[model samples]
Target: MGMEAYQAQFADHLPGGGPAWLSDLRQAAATRFSSQGLPDRKVEEWRYTNLKPVQAQLFALDAVSAGAAPPALLESSYRLVFSNGVLQSGANDLPTGVRLAGMAETLSESPGSLAAHMGQINAGQDLPLPALNQALSRDGYILSIDPGVMVERPMEVLFLSDAGTCYPRNLVLAGAGSEATVVEHYLGRGDGEYFVNAVTEIHAALGAKLRRYKIQQDAFGASHVATLAGQLGDDAHFENFDLNLGGQLVRSEIHMALAGQGAEAALNGVYLLRGKQHCDNAIQMDHVVGATNSHQDYRGILDDKAHAVFQGKITVRPDAQGIEGHQLNKTLLLSDDAEIDSKPELEILADDVKCSHGATAGELDETGLFYLRSRGIPEAEARQLLMTAFIAETVAHIGHDDVRAVMERLVGEWMAQ
Candidate 1:
């Protein structure tokens, strides 16, 4: 069918409607999607990962089935389930001091607090996916932690794809002096070709600690894009890890603002791709206050005709004195056709700040591979061993042992395939 057909199909799918904001957002999105027309490689921010993979095909929006077929309780632990973009609280096990449910419900319950951070951090012209989500998606899960509350369990946002294409929007708010952990997993049968467009906004209050993880493994013909915007306050800490093992094409955008003095932000990611898959990781951090600290480290392993891209930027404002920021990106390409791209940028305006960025793309050391082979290790085994060591550097930083082990195993599994 044509573009107009799909547009109408998507519009018709909206739940017969409610709320003035909901109606306004849909009309605005339709106009924007028409004019913007799915950004192309011409845009600087998306020069590497061409979005034609999704634009070339038609995606029929999946309808909302909030409490569809009770979500299975995976032995992995506490969780929340979102099927086809609607939040289901009955299917979840939420910890105390927090309320997890549809965004509409949260907004109705507390409009002042809900609208404070919604679309505030992750707003900009460079991010198209998030804009598209904000325009078309009206419902998502909201997690609000009461002040001084330390949650005991990790909150998992499990998005299960039921049909053709899905959009999952999530909003997270952590109150001052509160601590929590969130794990987001995109999992389903890798049979149907579809798109999973998701956006997550986080607000970190003073002295709050949050550890977040992302695990992506959808169908082979699927494409996925996710945007994460984080706002930090004094003494706040945010640690995020992303593991991209499977997706025909995947890209993740992390926009963080070290907004307060003494706040810290760390972004760590590992991407393992083989065959003709494509993956990109973009990290942009802004040191907006004096004495703030930030660090980013990412590693990618590619084989066959796969491709990997990493772009990171560290910005220091004029008055942001005594800022300390560092960034490092490394990639290992295993095949002649496989390619990797790395771009690290540092823009400093403060005189007393120390900031630097570095990037490198190369293959595993042939000497190390040869030495292992001469020691009686099989050639394939030798290659796998070296690949593991190359990515373990970033995995070692995870404070949680179980999460670290899961990440490492995912790396090994992707390499073995």
Candidate 2:
């Protein structure tokens, strides 16, 4: 029920006979997690979201069998399926310049390959969830792209969970002048209680372009917590979008650093919460050099007794001149009991930087709803139309057409509910 229970399971959960560096990493992470324990409201970054529910229950680290099948694969995309934190299937025919392998297998055969990328982005962070993930994670994927190569098809990784708890760690490396798109789809199979703690690290080299999308459709009884940490090199572009439609309690965190000049990063997300569901989105963008650009746009729709929180911060260093940073968060409360807390912050140490942030939480526009109803549309239909239009603005930023269409369809389904 507390940190002790998790610590008790550490030895049993750890992978045996791996490289010494990996073992040392896991041991260090275990020590850190033990010292910090599960974060509470006292922690500044986790002030709005509570982890008591997750800490109250002791989840099994492994499942006896896999659950139901995952969602249908996206058309013409390379797919990798993980059920209950174990690799179930993989694509046989990958692109020429792309290499995708499971973390467990990679560690066994070529453990030294991960020494450079793993934990490099999130080093020195006092985050307990990520530390716990690093200590216990057993199965995930490692994707690498060669320089100057363009991946023709999108890569999809589907994480399917049924019961118990699983820690998944993922890494992505994009070489110089390469371009690719990746999708992370998390789905729960049945109405069972479970927990998923995931961490993903990304590194984009100079002149590389990477687009990442995440769709969280966890079960109503599940709790999900995930962090995505990325670093961009000179002239590199990184784009990320998240769609949260399920999970009883969910926390999605994104941390990005523009470490090189001319780098760009964009973070966009949409969350639809109802029936007492709670979702939190925490984002941080750092401009470490000159001529870097970063943007954050997030929108949420809450009904019933649902609650949502958005915390976004942009920091421009003293030497980071000519940096452009902007953040905007908007929430539509469909019911009087629904609530939202939004905090947008800007820390500009450079006088030559242009940084701004804004947040708004209110009900849908009455005038737009009235106009839609005046056009002979029913009240429910008019409300749906208005809400759809509100979220469409953020969804338009998705670069891939198929992913965008799937997200739109999922939004429509959630609205219909």
Candidate 3:
């Protein structure tokens, strides 16, 4: 089916009908989705995981739990629930300097603040899900920080999907010299097949430092894709950590552009899969100017018949000098049928730049396991320790201890249980 036709199909049947802005966004999303369809395995970037299951299932773009409120998630410390893709409760009580309002409110109230950046990024050029998100997505929230402001608390935005699948689009902007940390967790409550098409646009202005932590804990029957698109100005920094523990199929695209010298960006991901679930982490970073740095580290552990995919490309333009970039991917296949495919690449056009990438796929190291056993440590605890240490290299770089503790605890619990 055509992108437009698919989006048109969705628009023609939207539920939980809202105000006018949502309707307008739907029209625009339909056009975008129509022009750009689902990405094929032939697309060099998505060769590892086939999305045939998603197409076969044919989920609705908007999954609204209208009359049925999401059951209480007692285990979740902080959560933001979105039934049918609309911000439910929990948003009304955010801390100061942290604003969570619908996209419509931002466009109307902070037009000057959001117009320049809204929908400006289209990773859809090479990916289809992003385009579909652009087309069928309704209103999500916008989080902004004032210049020179430092938000001490780690804000949690929990997105939940219920019986119906839904689309969510969110925008986050940090002003120059600002510092903040955000945690965006995607959770599903029921055993329904839903789709979470989400976009998080970030702008790290001059000298600003921002940290983003994304957790996807949807039900086994759900599928989701998220695009983390960020633009960093001079001396600005953006760091992202993604943890995928649920979902039948999950994919994430992270694209970034460094605007000025001294800017830096980091992308780190950990995907743990079991059963027949598949996960993909695709990324692209371009150093358009000079004196910038970027790093990417993605690791996966597969069991049962699980599968994983990773594609990374770091480009250094001729104009970019004194650039430093590195990418690495490592995977551990625990089962004979489990598999992982990785492509870590670097394209450099500048003579004065340092760029490198490496990828490895193998089973757990016997030497390390033996070393742990020699010390009286159990087999499972030893493997978990090694694996956590492998990922902790990236986690240790995080500036916020609270945020890191939460992530560490989550990973630990997953390993223990």
Task: List the candidate numbers ranked by lDDT, top first.
Answer: 2, 1, 3
Write the number of the candidate with greater lDDT, choosing between 1 and 2.
Answer: 2
Please provide TM-scores, in order, for all candidate models, with all chains considered together.
Answer: 0.90, 0.97, 0.89
RMSD in Å for all candidates: 3.1, 1.5, 3.3
Q: Worst 10-residue stretch by lDDT in candidate 3? A: 70-79
Which of the numbered candidates is closest to the native, going by highest lDDT?
2
Pairs of colliding residues, candidate 3: 3-33, 3-34, 4-34, 29-135, 63-84, 63-164, 63-165, 63-166, 64-84, 80-158
Where does candidate 2 stray beyond 4 Å? 1-6, 56-59, 71-73, 123-125
Over 172-267, each residue of candidate 1 has an lDDT whose tens digit, in order, gives: 888899988777877756355678888888889999988888888766688888888888999899999988887888889888999988899989
lDDT of 3 by residue, 42-64 (tens): 97776776777677444554344
C-alpha positional error of residue 417 in candidate 2 after TM-score superposition, expressed in Å? 1.2
Per-prediction backbone clash count: 1, 0, 10
lDDT of 2 by residue, 1-417 (tens): 356766776766766678898888888888778777888999888998899888854347856456656555478888888888888888679878898778988888887999988887853245888888888888898889999989988899988988888888999999999999999899987877799888989999999999999999999999999999999999999999999998999999998999999999999999999998999999989998999999899999999999999999898989889999999899999999998999887888998888888888889999988988899999999999989998898999998898899899999999998
Best by TM-score: 2
Q: Stretches of candidate 1 above 4 Å error?
A: 1-16, 56-59, 64-76, 87-93, 104-113, 122-126
